[model samples]
Target: MSFREMTITLDDVLAFLHLPMGGRFYTPGYATRAEAAQTCALLLGGSASDYALKFDHVKTIGLRFGFLQELYTKALRDRRYGPATQMWLVHVVGSMLFACKSGGWYTTVHWISIVEHLDQVLEYAWGAIALPTLYDALGHASQRKTKQMCYYTSLLLAWVFEHFPPTIIQRMEVPDYTEDQPRACRRRESRTGHPELMERQVIFDEMTAEDVIWTPYEEHRDRSSAAVSVDGAYADYEPYLIPEGVPATIEGEVVGNYLDWYTTVSHSVYHPG
Candidate 1:
């Protein structure tokens, strides 16, 4: 441990962590360059077993990763670490976590926090790694998407809402649970603030692959019903109709298949009548 670089080996630490200095030496969330570099070195050198064991030490904030019984049992008893050099188990774990986040698997803020708490990063692994791994395995489905993404969203939200540190929950402006809800007789009811506010999760049964359709919907999804057919034909959409507040009786309309008088006059069955 005595033999170290006199100056900050920023690239050495970054390369060891399998991290690319995206614009800055570290992400903007970190406090200082020294803090970030030291944190990266710690992560690159720390043992996974030690990391997992010391997770309980990070008492400042709660974690969001999911818990797997088998994984825990194995890691807890894992004395045979793979890498046997300066960059050890920490690099293996850190690289996996960083890849998952970079590949749009989980949130970025969590990794930044994890980097800051490398000595005791395992505790946050439940929130940061475990849960995200499960999520990525399942597919980054949006809440509004088919049942899968929706289910993921609910579990993720419910876990964060309920299991997250009371202080952490207070930081976010969640409709049900938040500390910043104005004190002027308008404070909202959060599960943590109000003990009775339990999240009633509805679990769905498993189905075959054919029956299951994964569709996660984003809030700002393009919901335009305007569609065209494969054969260059418009499917059920006629965009050339002129409105007259009533039945559009544009006789001899110069569009597709409108040869007869009645064919040209199409009425809007569903609209602002």
Candidate 2:
């Protein structure tokens, strides 16, 4: 099918859910084919959904479910359509626990399945974007590289469903740059490593530029490694947790400041190697 046809179908799905065809953060409102494509891409890829979920004002989880349901419908027609959708759904659900006035209560009672569904959604996302688009999304050195967080998040989301052993995850540590090896150098190691480098794995948390392309989605060492029972296991798999009692409203600012601090401190403390 042509790009126009595909986009039309995507828009129909978004409309079914009544989701606005619009920009996020920098851009707003669907204005052109390119803008619409971007909005669709963000929703399918999950950037749009994430921004909505971030706001405490987005009280109802149904809005999210409607979005996911639409994505699932799209996935059925073209698995790539849904699968390549953003991998941020988990974050979206998790944000609800914080975003909602009721805290985890509403999530536990109503939206649990959405949390559980992340594995399947993640598999599709990995299958879709884990290639050239993801690569192309990376800007050259002159331009700042796209934030590695989303790429790494996608990898981790896919891995969660893969039933990877806790040992593997624990061992799958991202290199800590502050110590002997900086994160950047470890990223270099991932890039330079010889034949069949994707097999040479690193911890999900240790992800860096060189390691962005490879994910555990395709190959699993052991099927039994999958964590079937959610319970606490899911918590272990998540990279970040909003500390209880930390106002979610302050989170954005705190996170921005923290990132700024981390960058400023990392640079000042250690000369780049």
- Number of backbone-clashing residue pairs for each candidate, in the order shown: 10, 15
User: How many clashes in candidate 2?
Assistant: 15
Worst ten-residue run, lDDT, model 2? 1-10
Model 1 lDDT per residue over 1-273, tens place: 011101212222221222222222222253343443344334333444443333333321111122222233344456423212213333334334433322123222224434344454343313223333435534554334534331123333333333233333332343562222211111223555432212211011112233322221111123312211112322334566454455444433344345443333532122221
Which sections of candidate 1 miss by over 4 Å?
1-34, 41-86, 100-122, 125-210, 213-273
Q: What lDDT score goes with residue 163 in model 2?
A: 34
Estimate candidate 1's alpha-carbon lDDT, on a 0 to 1 scale. Answer: 0.30
Error of 1 at 171 (Å): 42
In terms of lDDT, the best-performing candidate is: 2
| Reference-based TM-score of each model | 0.19, 0.20
lDDT of each: 0.30, 0.32
